[model samples]
Target: MKIPAANRSFFLFLFPLFFVFHGFVRNARFIRVTDCLVLTGAYFLAALILYLLFYALLRNSINAALVASFVMAFYLFFGFIHDPLRKHSIFLHRYSILLPVFLGLTVLLTLYLRKKAPFTRLSLYLNLLFLLSILYDGATLTWQSLQSRSPRFSTVAVFSEGQPACDTCAKPDIYLLVFDEYTGSRTLRDVYHYDNHGLDSFLEAQGFHIQGKSRSNYWFTSFSMASMLNMSYLNGISHPQALTSDDYTNVWEPLRKSEVVNSLIAKGYDIVNLSPFDLPGHPSTVSQPFIATNTKLITYHTLADYLERDFGYVLQRFIPRASKLGNVYKTNETVISRTIQASSLHPARPRFIYMHVALPHSPFLFDSSLHRRSPEATNVDFRLKDYLDYLPYTNLQAKQLITAIKGNSGGKAVILFMSDHGVRAWHDVSDFSYFFNNQNAVYFPDRGYSCLYDSISNVNQFRVVFNKLFRSNLPLLRDSTIFLQDSE
Candidate 1:
């Protein structure tokens, strides 16, 4: 099983490339093409450098390639090995122990490779394995691209057939402001023992009808948002099993190019996306804090992932300056500023502004006076005290945003102030019913709030809006709240 010298060297690069490509294929739906290319190039360059270093040390091509492969495999699969061991026993998973073990293994492997004859058979096996894996992933990626073009579950089909066109109707600038994880007034009173009367009063005084009994259609943000924007439940398209799955490609398609957005575009409304998620012809204004990025996905099962998950707080304590990089408050501030700026602009066509602000969500960044909390204070503990302190700041910002929008639009624009879902990390609360309770409010130019009911859910929010503003007879869906297990 003597393999050519050229073939042995080629497989060294192929293994690292295959690792990156495999990750890209698995998470292609979330990753942008540019991101994938950049990551792949970075991995390839690292592999080349490592191979050269090893070659210089060993003075043997086969030995160098083998050692390089061992190091790359160890680097890539560190988290994969660590996580399972961590679940069983914390002692087995510590970096202090694992690092030395990996180092010892690498040294032993390198020494053995230096002493032995050329391991052409091992090189040939790895080459075939990686080549076959690359081919398989390539085919999967190609098929997914083709499927996206002509999607089997078309979002257009979700809309009601024979819907009336509203070309001649008065199109007011519609503002859909979604405040993430803002619990309903009832949930505030029951779970947190806090009265949200101040914000409720402010909204009501501003001619906004607050849906007191409103709940989110789904527990998760993606599911709730996708259902609302599409004006339909994901009964047939997505099952309970799929809800827990990491692959959200099916959900993302309808979420981005929603039926509601398509309908609005058809009726001559300019889609202004200031949200944290991408939409049709418009990318996200800010990176989504809730979902992992392509880099995070590709680096999953590595030391980077372990540090981020387990020792993030420890890192934040020492490296306080770096904590601002993924601060939720920074993201919220950006969304608010962008929305205010966009509202000030006078577009020729009526605008459908979709602004999703992630506020009052962990890592709890701001306090009542809009001051940034200490890095040590920020946590995912779902503490009521943290949320209580953050709520006032959220209210203040909401008030400011409302005033700006109203002043800019001259009280003529249609504004829908709502939350994607309620506070999900209520660990202390025994009753999980409060998880579904969400904040919902609507403001129409003509004071037409009679159609909006208190118990209306997220799925029916846009339906009511379209019916009211565009004069379309889009039927309101049944208000139902479905709780998915492990939604958090």
Candidate 2:
């Protein structure tokens, strides 16, 4: 069968254009204009080979050159897709991208079998769609880069001369409580449909007004905390990639070393860290341990992730044979178990405690005590029970800290509670919202609890909190956000 001249000419013109467009889109992560040119040249070489094959097709020598040309295209595309050679690989952490390698192989086999016009048409359509998408993406990036601006962190001055006076008469310690992956109370009720009755009531009784819609300026723990502690969003850090790159990503470095602690200490305040995960007792003591708060400098963990350091070698060396060993790495279950139980109180100083509560993150079962009562998966599988069991443990920890502070007869307390982000189930990345995504609010997982991820529901958290903290007539705070009637 003879091929049409129009289709042949179209491939000749389209092939090179596709290469240039694809090259730009794929190499943008490397962002350097030099990487762009280099990838363009590499893509041109591959396209040049395909162009020669297109000529051979016109000359009636298509069969001999089919495999060779397809192989060239496969390699060209796979390099970007697989990212075998790039230093800054986006999908390097994800293995799912390998699924397409097999698809490419299938296409290669089809080309070898015959000049399948239908499949070839489908391929051309895919190429055109891809090229247009890349062009649009390039334009968008250009627009954003032009419009990008810097961020500012304003300093908060301390007020009040006499030590904070309260019913306890010790000191009014401001507790910045962050519940990771939690939404405002109303959203829980409206979206998730679970009745969050106790939390709202307890907060009201505690005299802390909740900010239902208090927004988190940054995503993940470090940046959000950086924004929180610095009292600003991270914009001036023009290199927003720094947040993900683990290069001096600490948003709290300046304040950590600054007089935040010293100011309270000067006023006879002892900085207290409640969560064992963030602050273990002391360096030499056997009671508790904390990761050194030098996150500002040690952006990256430097060494391989603990699992890779220990077993990645075996994985890379043996591939499939090390199946029994598995990818499951150290859970730190031992340190974390004794973590909740271990307590060392420093009653003498003004407390500037930072707790990084660990739960709601994977490998679900924190300990036997913090067990998940819900079924594993399917229609009946809900994390409410797991969260229920875990919440008590967390609440128990919160109560203990409050008790300790009151016991000391401390005066004046300011407590702030927040969550970094919501939990992603089945490796779903939908719960995350970055500036690049053009999304104002983050999305929660598929369990159908909309409150945690909904935009409107998060309004009252800190607003209510500050009201209670500053107002002379502090009223009991009640949360109306928990979804009691229906949470998926």
Candidate 3:
């Protein structure tokens, strides 16, 4: 019934290696091939070293390697299971420090028993099952890697380049500002019961045109921005609804080359990107330099790195910090500061500035005057007060930014303000009205464009702007909304 000592030793090492490999597959979009190789190789080398150490420590018992592998596998399994899903009510308070201590003692006890008891038939069967599981995981990873490389268009050009008559006229700088998860006026009044008339009044006073009831082409940020920037729905890509992260990158890589950006470039406009979306190459932070060489399309390099990122949520439960770099408050500050800088700079050449600011969103941390709110909402359910209070702060920041831009441009710039999607999907699950309704407004330099209507959507924002400035006859597309559940 006993298996070879070498066989048992190898099984222990392979089990953890395979578990980590399976995790890497799950987050294949976030991980790189070089990172995968390095992490896997590192773990294998660590296991080999532990195996040799255990061989000498346990009187040449291969079970020593099994003990080391078991501990490593246990830690990986615990992290994978407990980190992400812990936010749900079902997993709340289910884990404790004692749990890990107990697991360690159990592993030591197993090694102690193996020293006295003879290897049994059950042990051999268990080893075989582990081997089969490892092979299955490897197969799954191979299939996912193949799927990631599936064919899709790199770019979808919507407009043909043409010479414009406005070449002789003074070029007006354009601004596309995305205020994340800011609901429409109706939703603000009815659902959230907070009148946004103050902000609407401010925009009107600033010589801006407001679209009262407008929706985005897509519900999410990446998809919605990509559509607006490209001036086309993702219809060019096959099965756009079922796209993975890899598929998203395939379409998103052409953001700079999109018809909208290219048309501006042809008109002698420099593109200024002020979002993490254009990370590594061109993040438009006011003081920070963009380092393109040593960065990633996605920040996560391995499963461990992704899991470590989630530890902030757990840490927030015990330790309360006023504001961290990536927190919503700090992000809003950076967005506002960068926008102010971009506005005041008043660059010599005409510029197309696009800023995606994540505010009036989650981690509702700010009051009307940029003061910190209670950190208790850090782990609690969404509250109407939090969203409403944060709304005024967003309004203040946007107003300040717009005023600066207008002052710098001498009232000669074109500005478009909108949101990716609305809020309250978490509160009112059945009524997706709030989710579809988004905030939209625009400011034309000459006050000459009269075709803009109240029902115009975000998808057509750039289309109208381009038609006005470049004389490109890009027709507006019909607006539609899609509601997707988490399962989708």
- Candidate 3 lDDT, 309-354, residue by residue in tens: 4344455445544323135455567777877788877677998887
- lDDT leader: 1
Cα lDDT of candidate 1 equals 0.78
Better of 2 and 3 by lDDT: 3
Q: Which stretches in model 3 have alpha-carbon errors above 4 Å? A: 1-93, 97-157, 160-166, 236-257, 279-326, 368-370
Give lDDT: candidate 1, residue 281: 75
- TM-score rank order: 1, 3, 2
Q: TM-score of each candidate?
A: 0.89, 0.41, 0.72
Where is model 1 more than 4 Å wrong at Cα? 1-7, 27-30, 143-157, 236-247, 293-297, 312-327, 486-488
Residue pairs whose backbone atoms clash in candidate 3: none
lDDT of 1 by residue, 1-488 (tens): 33234345677888877887888887676667787778778777877777777777676777788888888887889877886788888785788898898889888887787778777787788888889989999999889877736432344345533678766779889999998889998889877889899999999899999898899988778778878888887644444634444534446666776888878887778898987666777776576546555455677667666666555666677775444424455677788998899889998899899988777666777777779777667756667788878898889989999999999999999998889889875566787778889989899989978888989998888888888877788767678887665422
Candidate 3 accuracy as TM-score: 0.72
lDDT of each: 0.78, 0.39, 0.65
